[model samples]
Target chain A: MADFEPTIVAFCCHYCAYGAADLAGSMRLEYPTNIRVIRLPCTGKITPVFLLRAFEKGADGVYVAGCLEGDCHFIQGNLVAKPRVNYTKKLIQEVGLEPERLEMFNMSAAMGPRFAEVAREFTERIKNLGPSPLNKKNRNKTDKAA
Target chain B: MVIGERKPFDEIMRMAEGLKKIMVLGCGGCVTVCLTGGHDEVRVLSSQLRMARDKAGNPIEIIEKTIERQCDPEYVDQVESIVPEVDAVFSMACGAGVQFMAEKYTGKPVYPSLNTTFVGGSKKEGYYVERCQTCGECKLYYTGGICPIARCSKSLLNGPCGGSTKGKCEIDPDVDCAWQLIIDRLKSLGMMDRYEDIMPANDWRTNRDGGPRKMIREDFQR
Candidate 1:
């Protein structure tokens, strides 16, 4: 049996990634159910605080999937999202978590299979990393002492 | 906008580490426009600090407050009522605000949570690029409004250096060549002929070189 299912939060941009997810559903592509997707108007709107809030609320993994660069409905939205993701990764590292837990991907609405593929790949990666040390279901308060 | 970025979380945490309770002072002036040390950033920084502390088993108490302008003594004076209750303060303002907080609450240790980056202007949303050095004098009229002190990598006063490739800086590949931008702006404004004249090298004495600069406008003075 799988050791534990990671609770991953995927912030999908409405223009592309969210549409791609809908396409995945229509195509009947199977992927890990661990991911909980939140649709955002644009990936650029996702701030550093949202990423921190995700960890604070006990998400095992966080993913931001946006439209391909230059394809964002709102021009340069993906570009803005890129630096923010990089900055937040540093914050996560500073808080004693592996930076790899936070990931960003670029995909188009037509890439339904790619969405499922990314989900499965991220799920497997998190599994190998084990449950988030912050996941309260699998850990106690003393685990946070550093 | 006073463009700046928050200090590394761990580094900031270390600065405010031993305090049981601390006040976070946010600036509502330049930093507010830059989205660095404004009221919203203060709230988020305080929350993040609290969480980091809790995770580390430290569990600190943070009180967030914003002043209209931390650099002004009139605004900072308001903190006196709240200052006595906290063990320390984490100033989220610029270098000026941080120093003002330190001066206002003399006995308490004041820490800076943001790195004072530069005097700059916002480009498109969320993109702030340096635009001025606050030199005691203004020469923007001669350069068609672009500031050589801040934008140019070398702060070239006259024209684009020979090293400019395409329209990018030679020192850093990612930076747009400032001189190139100035020329474009001047040409668009039909002021290209004016840019042909060479500018004298900057006189550092008039800048902060003579020491921290100050100005008194008699016209605006009481």
Candidate 2:
């Protein structure tokens, strides 16, 4: 378990979080390598199903990063995402997983440092929670076969 | 226009106990219009149930399908081939759809995922309030188009009960005094004279107080 490498998924909005990731790359900011970013047009495109699907498919931790509050490029897209993320938290808890495994964050496109910091913070959080039970179960099955 | 809401998550899991593979059937009718049970909802519920089962280490195989309308036999017939594959049918439709699916497949178990609520229209998105009880009789002409049988807590046809207070029912502050709404509507329509006529006692024989009711269109029948 000490050697476990958590697989994280970050649903980044193209206008902000994705651009921030691009800037993070340009600035050469160091963030954890656990994140696998899936760029979305806007966080408003997110539904509870998408987050639920991530955990079902074995993502150890998932976070949606959109534009800061009222600064959404498409007006209130970021505002629309907060509740869906919160609702998905309850859903994961219902599935017997920690609600902390999923989250939502907001930042402008220029906040590359914040993006890196968020990635590192979320990665560290998931690492402490350990591998998701779904993934762990798969590992156990593989070990049994071996 | 029947309204419904999903049963609690815990109740759903409890009802699904010991069931392995089951079909989650959704109706694209009233339940769908109300955002209760529809194609999107079926997927959401199926996904949730699968994750819950997986987390419990008791994984379940769920088949998801949404029919045009489960109340009709032709639509229910669409699942005849797939029905045999699952242990039971989890209907996300209202009670009628659930019973129809159950009746169509006598060998398989059928369960309702939504509590069949009332016949009503949405006040807005995701908000539903009962408007009719389908008491087999309607007196909207005298009641100013409001249904006392449904809107009134006591289903009082004559007027507001003693419990009415300042336009709200005593049952809850949120519940509007149905009779008050009726009286105001009547006054606005210049139909205040109708309010003076005391409504006669309703006939129980026309409602559920009678036995289960059925109607047949003789001309449409073979």
Candidate 3:
């Protein structure tokens, strides 16, 4: 609904979010196409460095979708990822970025509708916030060209 | 091995002022094994420093490098090429490494990002315990291989005072009495009679009390 099209990265768990994405396609549940998903073995493998790197590389919104609590295929993978998300949120905020740009969600592989719902909700949120201030370099060049 | 922790980010930024270029030196020895000054930490600190500098309107160029051992001159000599280009160096190694870097680069200022703790060993995977004082004295044979200099709260050599209650030291409720341990170990070895000999006070002159201790082998010098 707005000119700002947020560049979103979803670090999806291989066993859950990845499967759920496939289910969404199978069910024909349509969502925003701007989201790029990176499948990881488990959410625990997602370090704070990797999350910061995503933000540094022009990601307007970053989300970590892991298995439900106590339901992770790798014991406490989701649990480990939960605190790291909170830490990275604080770090991003300290660096003058909106903390809400980073989000962590838990869902099962069977929740195809929920995945689509998340995509829509997150896209709307980012659209309301407008473009990331860090991407001003690209915006300025585009504005001058126009 | 000495155990230490990284300084706060704000403090590190304050110490890094006026430097347009920085070289973050990381050690792959004790600090690396302790997870404070390893390659991973070097990258994180470099990124954070760069971001902080940029945010402060003073973008700094930083080069991240790590060595196998910072205390060894050979390992530190590897930075000869980059040391000349950087305005300053921020060492994440122990105090010895920081001093070594300062000595190596006479003109450039070298700052330390970590507080040097003491010669210790890990109690657990992530926990460390001070075990030696490097007092230039070896009395472990009589004390059942435990250094009273570090283990004892007061560095007492003969025995623990009445402050020891139920195997715990009075200084720290969580710490076990070093003298109690010495007695137990000696008893187990059927050598409790060794404790009867009146041990004299430790000679402080043998340590840093003599102003920077040093040792050399005359036979090997040639």
Candidate 4:
């Protein structure tokens, strides 16, 4: 349990978070290796189904990172995503998972340091929470079947 | 269009507890437009069920299908061959669609995955509000298109009832008084004079009180 490695899925908008990640790499800012980022055209493209799918597929934590409020390239994409992400958080909590396991963040394209900071913060949060209960249950079932 | 919402995940899981295989049927009609039951919804629900079942050591198989409209016999018949292949059907359509499927195929267990909520329209993207009660008779012409039967907390016709205040209903401050909206619309349309005409009590026979109603068109009958 002390050395458990959690798998975190981050949906990043192309215009901001994705670019920030690239900038973070160029700047050699260190972030968690456990985070797997999926780039989307915009944060508005992030749906509740996508977030749920990540957990179903054994992700310990999931987050959507988009442009800062009122700064979406699509004008209101991040604004639309804000409520959807909050709704997904409530939904996951209802399904027995901790609402903290899912989150939403906003950052500008040039915020490489901020991107890395978020990655570290989110990774630490998930690490303290440990692996998702859904993942643990699946592992136990597989072990029993074997 | 009729609006519906998905049933709680726990209830759905309980219904499929003993089943090894099931078909999740999605409706492409009102349910699709409302974002509850549709092709994408069927896929999402199927995946979730599969994951939950897998974690329970039961590993159930889910078949996902969406028909044009579940209330129509033609669309319901299209899934005949697939129906027999699964142990049960989890219908994501409205109540009418679920009953239609059950009536078409007897003996097989059909469970509703959604609770049929209301006859409503989208107030905006992703927001829906009840607008009609399907009372066989429509009085929209007299009420400036606002439906008292559906919007009024007490379903009070000819009212800005004693409970109305500041254009809001007493039932909930957030809800607007239907009669207030009707009056406002009438005032804007210069039809305020019509408001003076008293409305008679609604005919209960034209509503569900008449018991399972149906409309038959003699001209379209084959």
DockQ (CA atoms), all models:
0.16, 0.39, 0.22, 0.29
Q: Write the per-residue lDDT of candidate 4 for residues A31-128, one digit (tens) a residue.
A: 99989999999999988778877887778999999999989999999998989899888767656679899999999999999999999999999999
Stretches > 4 Å off in candidate 2? A135-146
Q: Quote the lDDT for A78 in model 2.
A: 87
Model 3 CA deviation exceeding 4 Å by range? A1-8, A30-35, A60-63, A68-106, A113-146, B217-222
Tens digits of lDDT, candidate 3, A14-45: 99998999899999999998799999999999
| Better candidate number, 2 or 3, judged by TM-score | 2
Better of 1 and 2 by TM-score: 2
lDDT of 4 at B45: 79
Candidate 3 lDDT score at position B55: 51
Q: In model 4, what lDDT does residue A114 have?
A: 97
Instruction: Give each model's whole-structure lDDT.
Output: 0.85, 0.89, 0.84, 0.89
Arranged by DockQ with the best first, the candidates are 2, 4, 3, 1
Which pairs of residues collide in candidate 1?
A: none
Kindly report which residue pairs in candidate 4 clash with one another: none
Regions more than 4 Å wrong, model 1: A19-30, A68-71, A107-114, A135-146, B39-48, B64-67, B73-85, B122-222
lDDT of 2 by residue, B1-222 (tens): 999888988899998999988999999999999987998788778877877777777877888899999999999999999999998899999999999999999999999999988899988977888888999988999989998988999999898889999999999999999999999999999999999999899997989989999999999998
TM-score of each: 0.71, 0.93, 0.82, 0.90
Docking band of candidate 3: incorrect
Ranking by TM-score: 2, 4, 3, 1
TM of chain B, each: 0.92, 0.97, 0.94, 0.98
Clashing pairs in 2: none
